[model samples]
Target: MKHADIKMAAEALFNERHNPLGAFSLGSETHRAVTIPDAVRRCRWIAVDINASAFGLFFVSPSPERARLVPCFDSDYPGVAVSTKFISGSNGEEMVHHTRDSTEPRWWTDDGSAAMNAMFGKLAWTGPMAPLAPGTSGIAFPVHADRGQCGLVVFTGSEIILKQDLLYEVHARCFSLFAAVARIRPSDAGRAHTISKRELECLKLTANGHTSEQIARTLKLSVHTANQYLTQSTQKLNAVNRNQAVAKALRLGLID
Candidate 1:
């Protein structure tokens, strides 16, 4: 498929109005499920990983060799070293398997198995393994639908060779699409505002009437970084200045 066509398809896949829990169902219903082959045919990758935590959902294609996911736990493989937590939800667990060197094929080793169990919790449900052939690589993108539920679409194979910049762009677009879908609120619900941790810190200091320079010093960042955070918060809040940014942030419950 052409690059533009792939992008359009990806946007439509992610932007569907169904709840996050329905991604897997959509995959089954649509007849054109997103998978490793799809990713490689359209983009480039040997494998992929997608997951969601309370902080936010992310889909990372061409993830590190050892990366994996468990939908039931809403977690990733070898959970020990990672800093994120799983988002609580009811979707059954899913896992994506990939290889760095497909020609010299190797299945999941003991370490890999152990890591999967540890990250997903012993009792979590597991999904089927998607294999990659020789000379290929893969990428996984996580899609967060709603209610802390999520799903993954993995792309793999050696057919498409991708550059780092292109891969990053693809994943960035994927994340943006996922976020847009995830932000839709139910009519009767009181939606919670979200700001990245950095944005929250900046807003808190701004609310205290700290100058950008002062906030930067306190946060151990350059004034430019502090200003950038404020700017982002202002944009997120649709506000005009530091004071308005803080007020709007508070009103939106973006910061405690």
Candidate 2:
């Protein structure tokens, strides 16, 4: 999409934010579990809406002095590793340097300012360096978590359109999305917690598309018992639904 199309869509979204009966309810649904597929869909939708060619959600290590960029969900480049002192960096590369030496022309909000226009206006891309893409231009929303941990949700395209109101709306949505993902994310030390043996069995069965009755038949248990196990597994996984529970289990390697 062209920059003008991007600008027009952003402006519409910005205006919709103020509509009392607006249908955009992403910010209010953060309490739900966010599966990998769900996140990817949201990112893709946002990218298309804003005319971005790529979208990524990255976890920035809490250690500012030796920060690491862990790509959680990237449309263009998944699992790319990079390092930066995000707290002190002034330019793109200093802030976030990709492994292939791609320099990201980005805007930092670690300073706690919600004024995106002011922050964006300060960006100065000087000197010769590889763009994040062929002609990368994007916005990064920094999401701060507990204990100083943080992450970034970014949108990039060959030509990106930015408006202060639109950026603010996107930032709020990014924060909500990040929180939903964090709930299902495994602990830094590895698996956040464990499910019971029965719970695991039920979750695996669910992943295989087994209904409660089928699971009960397979396990030679009552349907009520099978459902109980599935419910317990869902609760233990911190998921809002069976599909989410199955997805989380698969991600944590608890089930194939």
Candidate 3:
């Protein structure tokens, strides 16, 4: 799809008011979610510009991947940059079963089951359908051919391939916005805002739908301490609440 057309469609669909087709839109800016629950509901699987270290979010305007409805803050997040790789075990790289012609995202279906199980153990969820296919999945695209950082905006779920070029452009742009919003958040600082590993442990449990008291019991810590850890973690992430903290933490690679 032409870039101009993609932008217009994205703007229309991402409005807070439901469009005629009633597709879900999480506002024009992704960071507006500000809470883990909101973020998760919007995109079940998300990672921000992953690398060996560091993590961050943002939004792309017009395309629904970056800006609009973004809170007035001094932060500058990332853009929708992508680096899609071709899988081929022949190159001493991991390979997957996919059609070479398609630019859509791919996941490990029954095709890569053995290797996936060896790497991650058996996944418990049946995904969106029955009889689970286990393994890892992510979206990648070869945008930005030459200069600059690969504008990475990472989010994943059971995304079916939309063969239309315009739709693909829309999908990619929306993710770019998600990344930008994240990148702009304040980076972790020294001691005062550093999130503890234990706190992170608690945060993951909480993300798994656990209550504060349950997390405390599971960790064998006082309820007050459990709550305190959550509060501190939330503050460290600059999140409005524990849920946002969890979402931010997840995006930041602070938790699984």
Candidate 4:
């Protein structure tokens, strides 16, 4: 697809109005059903559209003193470590470095020297996908959010490639997905707002499709007390009922 076309599709996917093509949209149901997992599942199309064989999302903390990264999600590649070393590793350092240092999109390939010096072969994108060694060709898109939060969405394939224009546009889509997920999963500080441990447990059970009685049995609480906890949590979250409360709590990262 053209860069402009991809941009429009991304915007449509996150628009507030319900989109008829539910498969392509995250805002189709007023965002009530939106969750971090759901967002990741829906955005997998990025890799699919580009024919990438591997896809991964990493949340990055770019503090020079303690640069760290956490894998938020991945697909098409199992048992692969998308850890801090993966980002700072030789073949990857330049791509991720450009991202963290300048917040730019980068494409990379191992030059055979990476395996030798571990840092000598680090190079910038010079053209379309070149004949790359296995496990070395990929595009990294930097996503910067408020409060110094940032992430990298990486797409890799045996012979994957990207044009300069498409690189920027695809990065925009990555940013949109990241922003949507951040809104759904609030910061840890926000977790302290309300909802006691017991209340959260009840809500989590409710989210797992358990009945109040079942939750009571599992937690060894009276059905009345279990119901009360659910009610209090629902009220505190400003939700209309247990189900809505569970949804809100999930969005707020209060419950898994």
Candidate 5:
């Protein structure tokens, strides 16, 4: 699809009032949605997993399961632990929690990290999904706004082989729409304690290579107060220093 066409389609997908499950439920009663096949015909399977809690499944040409919602933390899937961390990274989050031995011997013994790197690389390149094997691929793209709740889109298929360009286009379009949605949604509801809006502003400026003095001047705060905010934010985010804190805040959506 042309860039303009992709942009239009993404806008439509983002505006469509669907459930948190994502594009997989396009035709369902919950929300007016867009069917994945209409956008990318070559896709054989589609699944969307969000926040490592909910997952929506879709298959265009059929597979083991036509469609389902599976829990992400289920231990039934051996390699899911490593894969989940990659997903967290893709969504710009730092650190993922997994139990000890969540890494299986059989799975880790067979070049698992290399495989994970390859898979995450493709996810970075192709969007958020990886092939179950050659010719069989899946894609999951996160959906969220700049200051809103987050979700995802997932697609998987085994019948049709997708082109590299088309895959890249799909990935980019999905992420763009996801970001738009994030802007419109409310801030995450479960946040226990958030950095004050002032603190976030300071961190965002700092992340853009601003000095504490610059940030303080920009925010109309004294240098000492600016430094205090930075130190407090860094501690809350568990960052080692100002630079690391800035990076972590951005990654955690604690700042712009």
Candidate 6:
């Protein structure tokens, strides 16, 4: 697909967040697990686990149909943890309490004030849903436990409000599944690749079949610089070539 096509696809996906290509019983361990084939035909699923000090990517949907959310990233990237920080980083406001106390999930968007926008806007993201970190729209469902330790946070790209009745089942089940496996007060999540913001944008466009020159025009960067981003992303993803990098990025939930 082309860049513009991908953008339109994302808008459609966002609008249709409550409607899946397939139906589900809404009684599954995770939101994505509720579906037999895939939850959202065009979207990918990511699980975020929170602990005492840091957050990490617990799972990325292995669906072949789901596109990479970003071009050169996965759970192994440091920015994943940073995203959590941005969400829970409010002054004197602990994150766990936000989930432990509330039964309902809360909605968040990166399209807030300039400060909020800059916080999530800088990270690497791609795909039709490539609303990058500083600006990705999602709902946070916190996992509460009686243990009084850290709570888990399950962040999904889906707006999730439209199907509140149905999606709540999936979200509650996700909490149980996450609580069971989560470590109490664990150490930091391991190292992840660090790709620049511009590199990610370039890689996403490139994945949409834009050549160096086309990417340069769209992004208003020089062709040489556009190619440079691809090369850098290729190196960071440790892929043999740009094609391999795209595939790896998708599997890693970096691009879509």
Whole-model lDDT values for every prediction: 0.39, 0.55, 0.39, 0.57, 0.40, 0.42
Model 5 agreement with the true structure over 1-256: per-residue lDDT tens digits: 3333444554465445343434422232212323432323212112221112222221111011111112122121323433333333332121011111111000011123344335434432232322222232333443332332334444433222334444444444444433433333223222303566677777789888889899888999999999999888777666789888776554444554
lDDT of 3 by residue, 104-198 (tens): 33223333434432322232211111111123233333111111112222222232232233334434444434433343343531221356778
Taking the tens digit of each residue's C-alpha lDDT, what string does model 2 give over 10-34?
3357446652223333344542567
Q: Poorest 10 consecutive residues of model 6 by lDDT?
A: 183-192
RMSD of each: 15.1, 13.8, 16.0, 11.5, 14.9, 17.6
Clashes of each: 23, 0, 28, 0, 15, 13
Which structure among the candidates has the greatest lDDT? 4
* Candidate 1 Cα lDDT to native: 0.39
For each candidate in turn, the TM-score is: 0.27, 0.46, 0.32, 0.48, 0.32, 0.32
Please write out the lDDT profile of model 4 over residues 1-256, one tens digit for every residue. Answer: 4333443654554353332223233343423335755655655766766666677776553323223444566663334444323553333444444445554455555534333222212433322332212445666666654444566787766445454444544565676666555555444324325567788888889999999899999999999999999989878777788888887665444555
* CA deviation > 4 Å runs, candidate 5: 1-150, 156-193
> lDDT score, residue 55, model 1?
18
For model 6, how does the per-residue alpha-carbon lDDT over 70-183 read when each residue is reduced to its tens digit? 111223242344554344233113333343344444444554445333433343221122222455555444443323322334343323222323344434333433433333
In model 4, pairs of residues that clash are none
Compare the candidates by TM-score and give the number of the best one: 4
- Tell me the lDDT of model 6 at 9: 38
Model 1 alpha-carbon drift over 4 Å, by segment? 1-194
TM value for model 2: 0.46
Residue 79's lDDT within candidate 3 is 28
lDDT of candidate model 4 versus the reference: 0.57
State which candidate, 2 or 4, has the greater TM-score: 4
